[model samples]
Target: MSLRDRLKETRAKASDGFRGGKLMSSIFRPGSPFRKGYVDSPRNRSYVVMNNVLYHLHPVKVKRHGVRLSYTLCLGGLSFFLFIVLTITGIWLMFYFRPTELAYVDIQNLQTTIAFGSLVRNMHRWGAHLMVLVVFLHMSRVFYHGAYKAPREFNWVIGVILLLLTLLLSFTGYLLPWDQLAIWAVTVGGNMAGYVPVVGAQVKFGLFAGLEATTATLLRFYVLHVLFFPFIIVIFMAVHFWRVRKDGGISGPL
Candidate 1:
């Protein structure tokens, strides 16, 4: 037998299930419209076919009606918009401010000397606040809707973790300005860490790097706020959204 013929015979003999069994794999029917050639149009029908064939990660049919503006607008879309705004404004603010003892001084200089710098800082601050609010609302909406059921329970757990991370992100940023508000907020927050059982002292020491919120504390929080949290949140958010799509789109109230 030829090499190609031998290979085909080997595959045919191996297992019937190898053809994609009924019990396994959500297989689309061969020659169905979904599997057929695309409709030819003037603009890029070939490209559409290519994309559909190449990227089959997303489901062929999303429940378009199930995805409502009322459910998604403030919860998902607004929060994502605020995240984008924070990322842009934060990067712009970075050009002028150093994450050092001079950090507060740089901010002061920006407010007094730099054009529209105060506005930039205010927008970042307010956006941070709004992100928190919207995230909380999102969580509540998901919870009330019973979206945590069955296959989506794990993703709901991830969403809860992301919520905590958002709060941590806000708390870390709170210390960056080094104003009285920032100082006292970190002090109180650090003290709360010390209130935890068993390894509380260790956690508090690690957070503050000794007795007080020193230069070390400022630098730690800065690194976390600007660098660490953003990276972590981005990854988690991507997973969260993917899982949403996977769990058959966002759930409606039970």
Candidate 2:
């Protein structure tokens, strides 16, 4: 065959092979359209909502009042957003943080020597504070609206756990700098835990790994701050969102 005809024949064969492939067949089944091809249409929209991991958390319909900014103030959403910001900034800060006696010097160097280090550190710090405040406000909003009744009672418990986790996350992170402020603050906090009736002393000992804030205490707090509590928060946050939908979207007028 001539070169042009030969090229056409090869192209036709390749096209046929692709059409017969199982991978392509599985992706674009005979009856189903391409996943992206479905948009705006009612069926496709429903499919998207049901199939998508994130979208599945939301109900098909939400109460008008439930979404009103004046009613909800969007505190829960803002808290989650600030959490994302803190996570991103925290990861960036981790590159420069040492979590040891040198941790304070490391932070100082991070602010002075590293590019944009001060900005990232400050964002993480402020984001953490904002998250705690927003989460507290969210709980208050839910409470005042009487959304914690009946079916939502369990979810309210989940929110309370999330609130505690938020506080714990902030507290654990506070000790990472290993400065005099961190040391004394943690020491005072540990002492307060010592006021708990039976387990107080044990809690205090576990907190500092001794009577004082030692290297072990720093490492323990670092692990909980960077790894443990964040993991638990993510899991509980998922449950919290899912329960919101399960309990009939955001609480609103009966």
Candidate 3:
């Protein structure tokens, strides 16, 4: 046989060796999709989806239009990817940050003293900004495509909640730098919150903890930025994803 044929034969033999081995069988039960497209029946589909978390995130079958990049632009995926990037970069940044009266000093040190600290901090900051924009675009795409209608309405609501939570997460993180701009932004945001009707004063007080921004306000925002908001957003994102799958996988072009 020719060299090409020999290489193909060798590849086939190696594939078969694993494909027919006990390890493969142990990892993928009979009729598993991982086993040569065995998920051709309802029973196999259910079994594979139950066993595989990757399959659980996506539909067993998708329409040709639904898989088109032009139609969806993969905005949701991009948004999720940015969030993960932020999470990782944010964790790395936490080691150098101190959310106290010395917060600005810590930020200065982070940008100058540590290795790649400037790069990581910029990634965290820009990643947050990108996530917010991408999420908004994702929502807009859903609306333009009319994917927000009918059975997916509830998921749409969940998406809106996630958006709000994302914005709040960004806002909370904004104050961690503790510069003049951050303080001024907090004052403006607090003032804006005070316009809310019944609980306006209480809301403003809770936000800043007093008449003006203080170290306590920084601490509160830090806790919310690093802990509270992330926890809440993660829960909502899970529910949003589950509801999307239940609502009929990804919506196809109309």
For lDDT, the strongest prediction is 3
Put the candidates in lDDT order, highest first.
3, 2, 1
Steric overlap count per candidate: 0, 0, 0
Question: What stretches of model 3 exceed 4 Å from their correct place?
Answer: 1-51
Cα distance off (Å), candidate 1, residue 239: 1.2
Q: What do the candidate models score in CA lDDT, each in turn?
A: 0.80, 0.85, 0.88
Residue-level lDDT of model 2, residues 185-237, one tens digit each, is: 88888899999999988989998888889978998999999999999999999
Name the candidate that leads on TM-score: 3
lDDT of 1 by residue, 162-186 (tens): 8898899999999988888998999
Per-candidate alpha-carbon RMSD to the true structure: 13.5, 6.4, 3.7
Flag regions of model 2 displaced more than 4 Å: 1-48
